[model samples]
Target: MVENRPWMTFFTHVVLILGIALLAFPIWVAFVASTHTLQTLLNPPTPLLPGGEFFENYYRALTEGAKAVGAPVWSMMVNSLVMALGISFGKIAISLTAAFAIVYFRFPLRKFFFWLIFITLMLPVEVRILPTYEVVADLGMLDTYPGLIVPLIASATATFLFRQFFMTIPDELVEAARVDGAGPLRFFKDILFPMSRTSIAALFVILFIYGWNQYLWPLLITTDESMYTMLIGINRMLASGDSQAEWQVIMATTMLAMLPPVAVVVLMQKMFVKGMTETEK
Candidate 1:
């Protein structure tokens, strides 16, 4: 549309196409591996085109699972779903309430608490893993759903996102609600929440991906095979020091692990875009 500059437009398209190809290359390799026989995949420059055994590989992964790690793919996927949903909803709920209070109320040490959260952002999970594990162990949370999800749910990023959005809301809306005798809870339910739907959707997409892709925390917390997430279980499938790695099944599971997050992003793309635009304004 800006269009007197055809060369600029053509260059832009070339760059985008190359970017897409680069991003898609790895996925294409994985997908091709999923369709191949294991022996063929192990050998040489590997087949670029897909071969037979696609259904056989996927069926084995979903049903019987890896021989050594026999936890079903379905079970692992369910566990992952539970963890991801728990984290996303838990973070959104707690973050919204905390942000509301921080933005709207006059409380002692509120600024202190805000800065404390920001400080935690600098101290990532990797840094405090030991102390956090100790606290979880003391609380009898280890190897449980609470162990897997609870610590990760209280995100500084989510809290800040909500706080910034809340600040953008005009004071007049709250004043009008107060004039109409609306209590804080009532005003939040009837007004603020409705306006925050897009933000929530956007956050859901990001948080779901964050939770779903978590490897280190989940690996540390859940000791039980039954509690293993898809990501963790997929790693289990890849290779034991004893057995040859099942490239076909592993690739299939990788593709499966990729699905729910991709589905969430694709489905919520419009709301995500709208939220990003509106929140910035």
Candidate 2:
């Protein structure tokens, strides 16, 4: 056992190092590119390290194309934030209500309702995109915030996750609450909600990332430049045929677009891990 321990340690280090490189490479590349000038980035061969023109590139990206549909990266960022937050909050609320109903209430066809939602998990958004777009259009939500938010509000995954987590809580706790004359609403508010904080945090991180990185749906729903999300804005920036595309600007905008999801992950890393582990338990 003592002799074998050294081999195990060596293999563990090798695996960890490889994992770190796999995770860090893209982030390092993005950071380095964000600092390069357009000329440097677009040169015959791009340099691998940070360049001196980071602030200049960021400034030009923000101020250069004022009249363009997705110009002023800040506006696009704000639009993305509003849309992401709306979808995250709305999805969580809906999921919580649905999960609670399924878990705590005895009603007809409850299992059927859950099965229907589970079916949605098997279906990709792409498969339903055309019909969903038609619904949005008919509702007069096209090119609007409602169009962007409403389609994402019904997250079957969140509901399923919450239901599974809620199920793990001991029935005795809920029974104790009821025995004390606490109603269902009071039990949920005082006991269930507080107990599920870690799971909720995990779900929030997942949902926020989903909303932030969404591309195709937002692109299809929003035609108005003012309402464009950051992903759409970045795509539009890339598509523009100008004298020369600003690689630095593109990278900077990309980095800015990534910040919120990164922040969410960093801030909630502990809660996210705890939530996943606890739910499994």
How much does each candidate deviate from the true structure in C-alpha RMSD? 2.6, 2.9
Against the true structure, whose TM-score is highest? Answer: 1
**Candidate 2 clash pair list:** none
Report, for every candidate in turn, its global Cα lDDT versus the true structure.
0.86, 0.81
Best by lDDT: 1
Poorest 10 consecutive residues of model 1 by lDDT?
272-281
Total clashing pairs in model 2:
0
Clashes of each: 0, 0
Across 129-246, the per-residue lDDT of candidate 2 in tens digits comes to: 8998899899999988888888778878788788888989999998899899999999989999998787788777777787888888998988888787888888887776764656
Per-residue error for 228 in candidate 2, Å, reads: 1.4
Can you write out model 1's per-residue Cα lDDT over 154-183, one digit (the tens) per residue?
A: 768888888888889999999999999999
